[model samples]
Target: MNTKRLSNQGGESQHQMTARFTNKVVLVTGGGSGIGRSTALAFAREGATVVAAGRREEPLAETVKLIEARGGQGSAIVADVTRGDDVVRLVETVVARHGGLHIAFNNAGVLGTPQRIGDVDEATWSEVIAINLTGVWLSMKHEIAHMSRNGGGAIINMASIFGVHKSAPMYGAYAATKAAVSALTRTAAREYIAQGIRINAVSPGPIEAPMSLRPGETEAQRAERYRETVPLGRIGLAEEVAAAVLWLASPESSFIVGHDLVIDGGVTI
Candidate 1:
C-alpha cells in the first residue's frame, strides 16, 4: 500500500514509505515527555491513532499537539496510573473514542530521590513502587483485558538498565521498581501470549532526556560521565528508544515474547 509523505519539525528526511501502524490505535502512558512522548509520536508518524495518557493534562496536550502537527491523529487522557479505576477508565476511554486499542506502551515511571537503601524514606519508596511497578501492572491488566477479548495486540513496558543490567549508588528504589517491571513483563508475556496479547519490554540506559541527569547535575557533567561509562561514549536519544518500541509493537517482532531487550550502550557488557 502507498503511504503518505509528511514533513517533520526540522525538515528532516522522510519516513519509510511503509506505514506499519496504519489504522492502529496506540496508547502510551506517561506520554507527557521523554521516551513516552517520543514513542507516542513515532506511532502517530506511522499512521496510528495515538493516545497519550498521563497524570498531568498540560504536557499530555502538548504531546497531542505535536502529533497533530505531523498530520497524525492524537489525543490526551489525564489519568493516574497508580489507581486501578483510573487505569481501567483510561483504557475504556481509548476504546470508546477510537473504536479499538491495538498497542499500548506502559511507560509511566519515576526515578525516586537519591538515597541509600537503608536510608530511604518510606514515602519515597512507596511512591516509587506505586508509580513505576504498580503502574505498569495496572496498565497491562486493563489493556490485556481489552486486547484478549477483541483480538491480539502488543505491549511494551518501560524497564531500565539499572535493574535489568546495572545498578548504582543511591538508586535503590528506582532499581527495585525497574527490576520488578522486567520480571512482570516476562511473566505476563508468557501468560497472555496464548490469548494473543504480545508483551515485551525495553530497558534503556542514560538517554538525552531530563531523567538521565542526576539531581543538581549539569548536562555537561552527565555527558562527560557517560562518555566514560557507556561504550557508545554518549547519551542515548529518546528517538533511539522509540525506534525499538515501535519494532516491538509491530509485526516485525511477532515471534519474540517475554524478552526484555536492553537498549543500553553495552553498559552490561
Candidate 2:
C-alpha cells in the first residue's frame, strides 16, 4: 500500500491517509488541473494505480509526476473525451497498460463563455454540449461496456450546483449541460447497477478554480462574494470535492448509486 501526507487545499491538512485503493486502477478524465488533478492525486494517495487522461499531454504528465513524488503509481494518457474513437482507445489503453480499470472519474468539462439562453451563439452552445455533455456520455458508454463485462466498477461524473441546485442567469449553456449530465447519470446508474456498475455524480459549487470566477472578477472579489452568499462563509476547495469523489469511488459507497452528492459549502441550500 502507498501512503502519503496530503497538503491542505483551503482547509485542514490530512497528516496521513490510508491506502484504501491498493491494487485498484483509477482512470480520471480532465486530470490535468483543478478538481480533476486533485482527485487524481487523492486516488493515488489511497494506493490506486491512476491513469490521468486529458487532451493536453504536458499537464497530464505533470499530474503523474506529482503522483510519483508521493510514491504512487501513475501515468498520463492523452485523449479527447469528445471523440468516440479516442474514448474507446483510452479505455482499451488503460486496460491494456494497467491491467484493469477499477474506477473512473469522468471529470472532463468546460465552462462555456457565459451567455443568456437567447444570446448564446451556436458555436458556444455546440462546444459546451460537445465537451460538457457529449464527452461524458461517450466516456461512460465505453467505460460501462468494459466494466459491465469485466466485473464492474464505479463511475463518477462531474455535475455542478448551477444546474443541479441553482441556475444563474447568463450561464444557460453550462447549466443545461450539467443538468443533463445529472439526468444521464441517474438513468445510467439504474441501467447498469444490475450489471455491477455503480454510477454517481458530484455537483460542486464555487470551488477554488478559475471557472468559479465571474468575468472581471478578482480572486478576492470572488472570495468576498462567496463569503457573503455561501453559508460556510467561503468557497470550497478542490481537495474537498476530491475527497467526495474518492468516497463515491470507494467501497464505503457501495450502495450509493444514482446519487448526486453536492459539495457546495451550503450555497445551494
Q: Number of clashes in every candidate structure? A: 0, 0
Off by over 4 Å in 2: 1-17
Q: Can you give the TM-score per candidate against the true fold?
A: 0.94, 0.94
lDDT of 1 by residue, 1-269 (tens): 11112212343453332378999999999999988988888898898999999999999999999888878899999999999999999999999999999999999999988889999989999999999999999999999999999998999999998886887679899999999999999999999999999999999988878788877899788878998988877777778899999999988999999989899888888
Ten-residue region with minimum lDDT total, candidate 1: 1-10
TM accuracy, model 1? 0.94
- Tens digit per residue, CA lDDT, model 2, 38-152: 9998898888999999999999999999888877789999999989999999999999998998899999999988667999999999999999999999999999999998999
* Model 1 clash number: 0
